[model samples]
Target: MKTVLITGATGFVGSHVLEAFMAQADPMLRVIAACRDRRKLLPGFAGEVREGDLRDADYRKIMVEGVDVLCNAVAWSSLWGHVADSRHLFLEPNLALIDAARAAGVRRFVNTSTTSAAAPEHSSDPQSEGIPRPLWPHLCNVVKIEAALRTAASADFQVINLRLGIFAGRRYALGVLPILVPRLKTHLVPWVAGGRTSLPIIDGRDIGAAFVCAVAAQGLADYEGFNIVGPEVPRVRDVITYLHDDYGLPKPHFSVPFAVAYPFAWLMEKLDPIVPWEPLVTRSIVHLMEEVGVDNAKAERLLGYRPAYAWRAAIHAQMQEMAVRQTRAMSMAMPIV
Candidate 1:
């Protein structure tokens, strides 16, 4: 049996990755899920669950056991934190995990990266550039990890870095969708400099499937980095409008200029350092209004990868999940009058 170790096995993408392996029902597969909190390890897995911090000195002792494959899915994805703290959150833990995995003689290593690592300098294609792009704080950490993994790549262990775009599915962060829906339905949202920025999106299900493909492939086979994203690109404003039409919500109302809305977004960020409960018009998201699409043809030709779900279908699924949650929330809360 081949043993596969998954880090961040309890997070949004990690959860799906775990489920994908379970659904396969492969007898030769033994999954070892590594998570920081034992309490977050949900039921229904036939494999072993190890609880430990990835940055710990003893991580190798705890996780790098008889493993053939190691998935680097752990990350501190918050928008705000001290730079030093952020670096520690991403750099140290990831670096330690990579060292441990290599030490364990893991035959294959998969590192999940973000497309934000590469910034677009200029682009004629509106879908490609000329927008305010948010400087992803964790991007440096990803690059550092990538560099370390590349240096360690030898005949002993093969490494593949999967640079993923904005992922959507049931467990998504629900960051931009709230702003999109309200704007599309009620037409009451302000435009972030005309909202022309194109954001690349990939369904989490497709990302999960890609991991399975990676495992099946077992080696890089002449490929190193792959951008895991959808074929078609959509602008931020259009995404909201599409959701409005799909959910039968009120059409969006774009009134104020994006620059005008920037202060409110700043205020929201100041008030809520954590992810905003609603989408705030910010410079980073404003850049998303410009093109942030990826070139995913590499994954297609090499891994035979394809997006399992279309962007519209992904949105519809999210809408359904949101409705269910809202209904449950309303049911639980009695009228305060």
Candidate 2:
């Protein structure tokens, strides 16, 4: 049996990936879930579980042993920290994992990345190639990670990088939506450039399918990258309006031009040390909103990846799940008569 070691198996994205692999019913595949908290793992997951920080050398050493494929879905970031902090928090540890995987003779390594790695400033055609801009911390790190993946690829090993679109699902806890939803309810979020820009969003379940495809893809080059996105490309306005209409929340009534918003975001970031929570907006977020639609054709052709959910349907599902959770919470809080 081939052993696949999945790091960050407890996170939103990682959990979905784990679910996909387990559901495959591949008798020849043995999955090993490596995460800090095993309790957070998906229910009824009958797989090998290893618990520890990936940064710990001993932990990584043990996790990579006898592993054929290493699927990395781990991510680390702070709402109010220097962009350079990403080097220590993300890049360093992941690079270490690559080394460990190589030393342990892992046959394949799959990395989960963001489509924003190829923002407009970096590439006119993100599907073919992307030049990472150094302005944003996340983009810069993705560039470095891609470079590392290329360098690590050899005759014996293969690398697959899935550049994923903005994640949309009930399990999604990070990114723009989670930050903006509550603010929109209070009428605190603003429309950037009248919210006309296209926002590429993919359901987490589809992302999981993409990871499984990456693992099973055959005749692939030593190094390959694919842009993973949803079936429909929705405008920023449509997303905000959907939230407002579906949940009866206040929509953004005002607009902020990029020029004005970027400076304000920079200033807020500067004041991050004293700020209690993340700023309402940031330059990176603005840049992401400005991106054009992502092309998933390459993924479809290469990995046979056909997205199963439309943006509207995915958002509706998330809203319904959120409502159900809220109702359950309220019901539990009420005193039993």
Candidate 3:
């Protein structure tokens, strides 16, 4: 049987991926869950649970042992500052895992990434290197991780990078809805570029399916990158309008171009140190709002991916979760230790 290890199998992305893999019920495959806290994992998750920290070199090595495929969904994300943490906490361990997995003779390595990692000039291509913004250091590290993995791909070792879209759905943690919705209630957020830019929101369930397809895909080369998105891409206006009409969340009172928005976001980041609370907005958030011309054509053709979830349905699902769990505005950073 082919052993497959899923790191952070309890997280937003990891949970969905884990669920999809179990749904397949392939007799030839053995699913192994690798996480720091197995207790947080979803109920009815009947898999070989390997509990340990990804940071531990010993644990990383042990997890990949005898594993033919390793899907790395672990992430330490921060919307705003914390450059040092972004590297040490998030980037470094992921790099170490790639090396460890490759050394352990893992046949396939799947990674979680965002479409924003692609350069604006080459927005359509998920494999393209993105422009690194100085304000958002985490994004720079994301690009670096991609480069490192791409370099590791050889005839013997395969790497699949799934450039996922804005996340929304079950186990929804920090994301567009969780972050932006509360701020919208403050009546502070404005429609950047008249809310025209496409919000490439993809549900967590579809994200899981994408990873499953990537794992099972055939005729794939040593290194493959695909833009994984929802069934349809919606505009910022369309999403916000629905939130206002359906969910009764306040909409942006005014509009600003990307020019004004970027600087405003920068100023907010600069003020974060003096302010007792998190910044109302950040450059990274603004960066995400910018046009990313991502589509599922490449993924569909290559991975046989067909996204079924729509944007509105995903947003509603997220709002429902946020209503119960989010008692306060979400912090800028996600630190898992």
Candidate 4:
């Protein structure tokens, strides 16, 4: 049996990966978790939990020992703000984790990443060099993480980076949908570029399945990357229209080109100190509106990844969860910093 250690087991990506690993019910696989709080793990999860913070050197060192594969689903996200904190809280720690995994004899490392990491013009290139955005520091750090993995990969230590599209589904609160849907309710959100760009949203279940494929797939290179998106990439207009018609959410009342939207967003960010709440819009959100012409062809050929859920179903699942939870609007930064 090949031992797989899943970091961030209590998180959205990590939880789904754990579920996929367990649902397989294969005698050839042995799964465990590394999370700070074992109590937060999914119900019916009877696997071993190596509980501790990744920032701790000892914990990072101990977690990957004797593991055949390390699925590093742990992620720190912020759509805008918190530039300085990212290096210490996210980038440095993830880099340390990668170092630990390599030193502990782990043969394979699977990393979590996003599609927007690349420049909008070069997004179609699955493994293109990531272009940094000053408006979104955490996103810029994601690019740095990818570069680190590429440098870390070797003949023995194989690294697989999953460049996932926008996240949707249950057990998560911070994403485009949770932020956008609430903003739409205010009836102030406008269509950037007339809502014509593609939104490559993917279901949490599909995200899990892709990881399963990467973990088991053979004949992969030492450093591998794939763009894993939904089966169908929906237009922004179609998604907002569906919400307006079915869920009673409001659609964008007007349209603005990218040139106008970026400046407006910058002004909102400038008003941060005086405003009682977070900015209604920001440049990072506008960045998400850019056309990311990504597809699933590469993932299908290499990892045997096939996304099963549609955009509507994924949105519906998140909307339902937000109703029960999400007491307040999720900010672009975690811990409000």
> Each candidate's lDDT (Cα)?
0.65, 0.78, 0.89, 0.89
Give a tens-digit lDDT track for model 3, residues 114-181: 98887456768877766676778999999889899899999889989999999998788778888898
In terms of TM-score, how similar is model 4 to the real structure?
0.97
lDDT of 4 by residue, 1-337 (tens): 8999998887888998998888987788889998888998888888788998888899988889899999988877788788777777789999999899988999999999988988597787777767888788888899999999999899899999998888999887478998898899898999999999999999998999999999999999999888989999999998999899989998899999999999999999999999899999999999998998999998899899999999899999988998889877887865511
What does the lDDT come to for candidate 3? 0.89
List runs of model 2 lying over 4 Å from the truth.
79-85, 122-135, 273-277, 320-337
* Per-residue lDDT of candidate 2, residues 1-337 (tens digit): 8899888898768998999998897999999999888888999798899989887899989989999998898876433345656676678889999999999999999998877776765433433445665447656777788788888887788999888888778675566665566667667668889998888888889988999998888888888888889988888999888877877878888999888878888886678679766566667777778765577887889899989989887777676766655331111011111
List TM-score per model, in order: 0.78, 0.89, 0.98, 0.97
Candidate 2 yields a Cα-based lDDT of: 0.78
Worst 10 residues of 2 by lDDT: 328-337
Could you tell me how far off, in angstroms, the CA of residue 266 lies in candidate 4 after the best superposition? 0.6
Deviation from native of the Cα of residue 179 in model 2, angstroms: 0.6
Pick out the ten consecutive residues of candidate 3 with the lowest summed lDDT. Answer: 118-127
Error of 2 at 49 (Å): 1.3
Superposed by TM-score, candidate 4 places the C-alpha of residue 231 at a distance from the truth, in angstroms, of 1.2
Residue-level error in angstroms, candidate 3, position 53: 0.8
> What's the C-alpha lDDT at position 271 in model 2?
80
Residues 247-327 of candidate 1 have per-residue lDDT tens digits of 676644554555566566666556655653433344445434545456668677777777777777777777777766643
RMSD of candidate 2 to the truth, in angstroms, is 5.3
TM-score of 1: 0.78
